[model samples]
Every structure is written in C-alpha cells, then in structure tokens.
Target: MQLPWMSRTDRRHWKSARTTAALGELMAQWLEGSISSRPGYTPRYGPEDETRPLVPTLAALCRAGYVTTCSQPGLVGWGADDAWWEQRAAVEGVVTDPVLLHRLVDAATTAGLLVRTIDYSRNAPGEAPIPVTTRNCETAGEFGGRISEADMAAQWRGLNPDLHDEVSHGTYVIILAPEYGPTGNRLWRILAGSVQEVGHAA
Candidate 1:
C-alpha cells in the first residue's frame, strides 16, 4: 500500500492512524521472519522464520493490487539498485529521529537484540537515498555530542549490543544518513558502551 506521507496537499487516506499502525504491525511481523533470513528482507522466508509469517497479509495485499514494493527506481545520484522486488522491504516510514526509531523498534520486537541499517538500498519511490545529518558526538576534547548521551543509550541492556544485537535479525534500525561510517557507527558504539557501563555500575 502506498503511504500518504505528511503531504501538505491532498487528503490522503493513508494518513489515518489505522493504516500506519497496521502497516507498522505488518512490518513487525515481517521482521520476525527476516531475522533468521537475509539482511535486505523477509520476503524469502527461511528455516529461522515463523513459518510464512507474512504470507497472509502479503497475499491479501497483493490480491487487492496494492503497490507493495517501491519499484519506481531512485535517481542516478541516489545510487540505489533498481530491480523490481530485488531490494525490497515489507514497509518503511519517515522519522525525524531514525536512531530513536531503531531503539524503540528493538524494544518493541522480541527479535532478540536485533539491528538493521536503513539506507534503503532499493528502488524507493518515496523514501529513497536517505539523508545526512549533523550528529552531536562526545569527544574527550570537549564541545562534542549533538544528541544527548542518555537519549542515545540503548534500551536493551547488554554487555555489547553491537555484538549481542544481530543485524541478521531483520529489517530494523533506520539511520537518517545514507551510510553507517559515522552516524550509524556512533549510535551503535554509543548504545553498546552506554549499556555496558550502566550494567557495570549496577
């Protein structure tokens, strides 16, 4: 189903809380299947999946002729793959704080310390190419850190979230930036150390 994002014009029916909620719910379900599957998706279920977890909803959606994957293909500068259903996700949403979304997702799903990057390296008709943002980093030299350390901490307590958290779990975690080089790395590192430190302090 095509998401009627927060567009200024047009009374898009997808704006309803029900649609978004249902979609997010479906995404959660798909993630459950993806964890034991592949990095780019849950479409091709594996032995680790919950036995055709998304088949029902997906089949119904397909029968109804809803645009499932964004196969519209991204612009050249975007550097995204453009093969139908090649690089697809069950669903995607816009957010101001992608890191927070990632953490919240980790807390919401029992996928067992899961993690996934949101570069959306697919044929994104809408949410393509990802964005870049200035993150506040805490350096020993002082005058660092854009987002608060506390806010950046991982919700899942662990000795090392980056280690315990398996990226193979599924499609979760969305970094506003296109690459993990700095922002994504910082989030993972920060959350990992913060969680470890708190665990030790306790």
Candidate 2:
C-alpha cells in the first residue's frame, strides 16, 4: 500500500528501506543464535551503539503502519498490515519509530480494520519467556535482570501506591515511557492478558 506521509520520490525512502531490510536480515541471524556484525558498519562509540540501522527502518515502517511504540524503551509492536494500507490512504506523514507502527495497528484493530491474535509462551525451564510478536525473541528476557517476587512487589508498591488495593499475587511490573498513546496502551493490556493466560496454561 502507498503511505501518504511517506515521500515516494525521496532518496531517504530508499535508504531507509535498505536499512530496514538489513535489520530484518540481522534480526533473523540473531534469532538463529548467530552474531555477525554488519559489514562496513563500525561503531563510532560503544559496542551497544548499534541502533543506527534499526532507527530509520523503524521510522519507515512506522510511517507505513507496520509497527507501534510501546512503553518500554527500544521496544515496539507489530500492527495489522491490512490496516496500514487503509490508513495510508488518509494522509501523508513520517514514522520515526516502530512503536508508532504498533499504535497504528492498535488503532486499526479498534476501528475494526483488522482481526489479530496474541500468541505468547514461556521459555523452557531455566530459560526466559518468549514474546512471539517480536522479531527478536532472544532479547525478550533481557528487559530486566532477575528480581525476587517479593522485591518486584515492593518495587511496584513504591511506584504505584494506588495499586495497593489490587492483589499483587503473580503480578510483574515494569516501567515504560509516559508518552504512550491509546494504541500502545491497548497493546500492553493485550500482552499482559496473554502472559496471564500462558501462565495459567502452564
């Protein structure tokens, strides 16, 4: 589908597409337990500064409605591809983050633009949980270091005193950026529900 906000004639579009496609390929490699750096892409700073290839591509996808922003830093969601096409018909814009793509997906879903399923699973014993919606499942468990259930509860309490009225059993809380929109909020809710269901099934 043709996105209105995206410049079809811009050279940046081609560059961003290449970057996004390269990131996709690299993500595939990571998922397969392989770690090979992209050729000719050397870090100007720390080893952790490898987000260059991901950023612009994410912007393109977000502009194109392929993903959405999430509460977590460097995290995003996959939106309905069909809805993306429909939205593309409305206006022209630029998506600077993949998280916006997810937001578009959420908007599309709420607008009855598409139907989607949330699939979630726990990793094997001694392993981390797997978020099926992400392209890089290996990074799912790295969000936060291990914390005792009691500590988790204490942290949650510290952050949300109002939640004290709610039961804390089996609850896991993580902080996210405050700028999230309605679509991102809904996606988080869905993800939480999926986690609860998976835990119950196990």
Candidate 3:
C-alpha cells in the first residue's frame, strides 16, 4: 500500500519506493506487536546516538532518523551479510570488474571490516569479502532478451560460487560510498544487528 503521507508525485518518482514500502509494512507489523524480537536480539532502528528506545512505530523510526522513511538519492552506505551481497549481484545495475572490486575490498579490510566476497583466485585467501554498492535495478523487461536468469546466475556464480547460498535473496550491493564514510567497526556492528528476525508474536 502507498503510504498515506506521501504525495502522489513522491510515490511516482521515488526509485526505491517499493523497497521502502515493503520495509514500512514490516516495521508497521512489528510496531503493532504482531511480531516480536527473538531472544538475545534487541532490534533498534534510526541513528545510533538517539537515546529514545525504538517504539515499533514508523513515527518512532522517523523520529530516531535511522530507518529512513524515504530513500535518499545518494548511497546509504552499509555493511551486510552474504545474503544481501548475493541479491545485489543478481539484480543491481552497478557492475564492477572482478580485479577492481577485489582491490576495493582489500582497502576496506585494511581499514578494518570483516566483509565477505567471492574469492576469484585459488591461491588467494579463501574468504575474500566483496564490497557492496547501492545502485538502481534495471527497468522491467529491459534486459529480457539480452540476459536470461540462468545466464545471470552463471555470471553471479562466477563472482563466487561458494557464496551462492548466502546472497541468493538479498536486494542491494555492498560498495563503500565516500559520503557514508569508511567501513570500520561501527559499520560492522550495524550490519551485524541491522536486521534480526524474531519469533512470532505471542
């Protein structure tokens, strides 16, 4: 459903509207107590410095200013697990050459991030991490004739077959944006707990 507060044009023009909407629905469900956090995990949204506890409401998320209500035009740099990386590889438009991509990942690692990527060389380390980036998805049917799912899968597998299972369903890439600052311990922690699936509500 379209958010009640959004202008018609805003809904029409937002590139990541669907993703935001989907997340909103999930957040709404959580806020209404329809879903609950699982043990050993406390879910928080919005900016890290905000002291107010998350109230499970969009207003609260908005108020805290971490879980963006609207998609920002620039990259919202974030770290994520293999699932997110896989999803990004399958669909996002930002394609990087393997060698160059590895260099960036190496830089991030040097700066202190435990990122995970597909290892391109057998002699290289087994767990090289891929840096994710934010980019648009291709228009519907744009590549229909050009690339088949099997072909895309093959290409993604080439990026790292061992990573297939983890990133197969995610939707965004993990590239570091200058605007978001360098990947480090803070970003790592955020990624680690950013999305937690709790058990069903009691």
**What TM-score, computed on C-alpha atoms, does each candidate reach?**
0.21, 0.19, 0.22
User: Which tens-of-lDDT digit does each residue in 1-202 have in candidate 1?
Assistant: 2212322221122122133233333334443443222212332443233224334433233222221221111111211333211111122222223334444345324332223333322322323233222123211111111212232232111113342122112233331212323222233233334324433554
Off by over 4 Å in 3: 15-103, 117-202
What are the per-residue Cα lDDT tens digits for candidate 2 across 1-202?
2222323442122223333333333333322324222212221221232233334433343223222222122334443542211000011111223343345445445543222322112222222422222332332222212344464343223212232222122112222212222333333344334324433554
TM-score-superior candidate, 2 or 3: 3
Best by TM-score: 3
The ten-residue window of minimal lDDT in model 3 covers: 85-94
Q: Which model, 1 or 2, shows the larger lDDT? A: 2
What are the runs in model 2 whose C-alpha is more than 4 Å off?
1-70, 73-128, 131-147, 159-162, 165-167, 170-202
Model 3: per-residue Cα lDDT over 1-202, one tens digit each: 3424434543333212234333334334434444342111232223222111223323233222122211111222223532211111111111123333344346445555433342222223333332333333322111102223464354333222333322233222232222222322243323223221111111
* Backbone collisions counted per model: 4, 12, 16
lDDT sort, best first: 2, 3, 1
lDDT (CA) per prediction = 0.27, 0.29, 0.29
